[model samples]
Target: MKDYYEGESAVFPLFLVTSSDGAAWSRAMAWLFPTLLLQALLIVSFLHLIWDWFQKQSFNKQMFVLVWMRTVLGGLAAISPSVGSLEGMVFMISEVTLSIHMYVLFEIFLQSIVQAGIFLWLAKRFLILQRK
Candidate 1:
């Protein structure tokens, strides 16, 4: 009954908190903030494209297609399993949006090209008529 636990000893690992070397938590926050910001930007830009398209009342058919496609893609993204898997879906969304943006830009460009070509052709014809 005197001292059965007298010689018992216990050792626990000690965690040292140091300021000169930043903690793992701060480094993680630094990396995470930028990635989250980029994702946010992608979403914002896609939404802006949609708003602009609707505002213009142009490309009715293409706009409908884009609207439906984005709706489905966004739904899928919402239900996706986790961030890792959803990252690919986000890329897919970005690709689709960019493709639409490029198509819209190209339409404007090609229209200008066609208009210029027709104008020049008409000018050449006028010159021929004047020469005759």
Candidate 2:
């Protein structure tokens, strides 16, 4: 077992055995497996939400437009810092804390926006199809 580090702080523990041959593969799998699993779960949940919304026959065009705007603006705001840094541009902006906590919050926010958009869009499309 070894501790992975970024800068001076120990980040996470890496469990390793005597065998070096399979170490790289194991490490890759450790990261990839959980990511793939979570993505699959999210997709399944989002689809379920869409189905539920359709079954309930709840579709609002006004709300869809509002959510679309929110999602687009929120996504742009989240990526602005990275984009500005990469472009060597600076604008008057309040300092935002960058930490694990902030990262998790941003991820949750983005995921909600995505799920909401998907749900509303599918519901609207299905409602239209039913009408025609």
Highest TM-score, which number?
Answer: 2
RMSD (Å) per prediction:
22.9, 11.8
Worst 10 residues of 1 by lDDT: 9-18
lDDT values, one for every candidate: 0.43, 0.47
lDDT of 1 by residue, 1-132 (tens): 112112222111112122223675477567787986785567447646775554454444444444443343433344553121344335433323444334433454454445334534554587699999
Clash number for candidate 2: 0
The sequence of per-residue lDDT tens digits that candidate 2 reaches over residues 22-50 is 78657776788798678657655655666
